[model samples]
Target: MSETAVPLPAPVFDPARVRSAVEERLTTFLDAKAQLAAAQGFPAEVTDVLQDLILGDGKRIRPVLCVAGWRAAGGCGDEGPVLRVAASLEMFHAFALVHDDVMDRSATRRGRPSAHEAIAARHVGRPDAARLGMDAAVLLGDLALAWSDELFHAARLGPDQLAAATAVLDGMRTELMYGQYLDLLATGRPSADVDAALRIARFKSAKYTVERPLQLGAVLAGADVGVRTALSAFGLPLGEAFQLRDDLLGAFGDPSETGKPAAEDLREGKHTALLARALRRATGTERDLLTGYSQGVPPGPAEVVRIRAVLEGTGARAEVEVMIEERRRQALRVLEEAGLPPAAGAILRAAASTLIGPAR
Candidate 1:
């Protein structure tokens, strides 16, 4: 087995181009909405926050997937409605992030203070900074959730297609919530069984991240069940590989590149595959070092380096890299078998390769 044997499709469509197109469309929609809100005498602060959240830095992968899926499923329509649906996904994602940061007590998002903390920082002298910030962010998140539903309702799909797409969205939300609970449970407990941890990662990270977004697009485009199933076969493994790579970066990636503290996962005592493997394979003092260095308010940088050394020494890093390669290969196999539109599949294949293939 080669370390990475996944054959990617040619780049039929550039992801950066697709991302730019989607961002422009979303900005237009948001600008129109902001103007309408201003005409209604909405608070400027509210409108500003809404606009910033919508136009903030993001990869815009979900909506792009929605549009791509629509194209792949033989849908012939203006891209506008599909873009709205995709933008709606972005709003829902904002809701998730706001709440997630609050739960994780994270200080930053996309290289800025998190929504709650940002607002809190503005009123540092106020006695209720934390409360005010949390309240504002909660309402903001709620607004985004409501907007997502409204946008979905306004999409161009027929009644049956609309119902099917909405159902998928609901399922995605439910599964993500459950995955979060599983994550909370796994922390500060006995380390999850390796296989079980992977299962949780798939449901929590992979499905919501990739499979659901693609399914939404396919569903809205009225794809048959066979097509939808085949896309899942491709999306699930690719999504899992994506998260696995994220786990590696969380521990070992340069902070300048990744925009988060390195070894933050270790500080959080995250039971990722890397950590689980280290726990299982380390011997004597290395195992003791890992166990001892796993938790605290802020793990020291030297300890993080030590943890990395332990992971490398135990072959866990190599194992994880190999697993990522295998998952990518499996995803490509599914894509080849799915008989999707060659051009669309080619684009998706390239996106997946860029997402999960070895770093350049």
Candidate 2:
């Protein structure tokens, strides 16, 4: 299997172009909301914060995958409606990120204050500032979600397209919420059950991050079950690889590079596949040290250093790397056998690299 599925997609299917088009649509949509808020005497800060968070730097992966799915399933011509739907996916993503940060109490994202943090910072001196910020951020996330719905409604899709897209969107939202719930339950309880950890990754990140987005686009193009099935076979494994890489990033990536606190998963005690595997492989004192962490031991600098040693010593980190590679290769093989449109296949293969390859 190819190590890297090189991407030379046509301009219309290019990831960069898809990202630019989606971002511009989001900016325009938010600008209209801002104007309406000003007219209604609503707080401008609402749109302002939404703008800063949604318009902030993003990989736009969902939107890109959606478009790729459409093209792969033979969608073509007059991409205006498709772009609008893509932008709505991004709005939905902003909702997910805002709530995710609030849930994790994450301080920063993409190198800036998370939505809750930014909102709290705005009212620094108030006695209820922290609580107020959390409340406001929750509201903001809901508003983003509602607006995403409105955006989708306004996409002017044909009746067939709308019905198809709605079914996929409904499933995606439900899966994402349940995935998050699973993750919440599992947090602070790292375990040796690698399958359990993997289950969380599949629902919490894999499906929404890859599978549904692909299906959403394909359905919009009136894709048959065969095309959607093929995409799923390719997407699920690749999505798993994506989440594994994210676990590694949260465990060990630099703050400057990852734009978040270091060892966040460790600090939060997320029961990730990486942690699960380490627990599985460890022995004696090393196993105890690893178990101590799963039991809520503070991951202070020295403690984290020791845990890192355990992760390395047990070769769990290395094992996870091998897992990622295996998943990636599986997706590549699927892509090859799926016999998708050449251009669409190229776009997806390229996405695989960006999703699981070395982080930018």
Candidate 3:
């Protein structure tokens, strides 16, 4: 039988405290790895760069949600194992981001050079610098993935908890990889299939980012199927809304705030819903510009203005805003009906607001 502890009365938890614990766990784990690498004469630069990326100014959203899921599912007693699991999730996230950036050829991450770019920059003069960076960054991403497993193992879960958590983690990783595959297949070959774009978002962001993390925590707490079901109901639509907002911000948000190159998504010809809507409504030169995969439009002021006009002029932006709102409402309605612990519901409510910016 699963070893779920009884829920504390009302089970109030501070998000700040959870975030701090997860951060500390990641920091200390990485620190030990760094020292071991130094003593063993492994390349110190690997851990050095990873430290900056993992311990940087990330929002710690996944880890916090994991803890919230734990509390919501009546996890009690030692919080240590759950925190370590949360940190492992973050490390896995770092792996995903590194590979995603490589796939996107994204030069920047969080307003700094991305992993490949940074590695390439460090060895500026080599003839194979670009290829070398790409290769080395893939290795770095793999290392992060490896460490994620190591940290997860070090959590020292009991037999039942370990089995359950492993199932959740395995499913999450498999779904994420296949989602990335779908995304890669669809990218740069956009069509007016809103459903197609949404499918990508569902797998790529919704299930991978929100649903699985919440489930992982719940499973760690030995939650029953019913509680896990409630979490999925609450998490899926909210996660999709989160990605929809991300698509908008990618095309239209302030680069400083978003921490990426302006219009990076459009520049890559990503098959986002916003782009699909625009294509469905566009005509003549507007359509031509939207389909200009081979035109080599330079990422400059005029190009930015023109693409902005396209996304805005077609009403796609407004349409997607409606989509986001609709999904957010759906998720909230699920929350109200899920009969979750009050504290978990509150954390999720706040999370929804923050992800989509407090509903205008």
Q: What tens digits encode model 1's per-residue C-alpha lDDT throughout 137-244?
A: 888778778877877766667788778988999999999989878887786442526786787788778998889998888887889999889878888888888888
- What is every candidate's alpha-carbon RMSD to the true fold? 6.9, 5.6, 4.0
| Tens digits of per-residue lDDT for model 3, 258-314 | 998777876677889988999999977987777674233446767777878988999
Maximum-lDDT candidate: 2
Model 2: CA > 4 A from native = 1-12, 283-300, 358-360
**Clash totals, every prediction:** 0, 0, 0
Whichever of 1 and 3 has more TM-score, that candidate is: 3
RMSD of 3: 4.0
> Which candidate number would show the highest TM-score if scored against the true structure?
3
Write out the backbone clash pairs for model 2.
none
- Per-residue lDDT tens digits for candidate 2, residues 261-298, read 65677667788999888888788888666656544345
What TM-score does candidate 3 reach? 0.94
- The lDDT, on a scale of 0 to 1, for candidate 2 is 0.87
Clash pairs detected, candidate 1: none
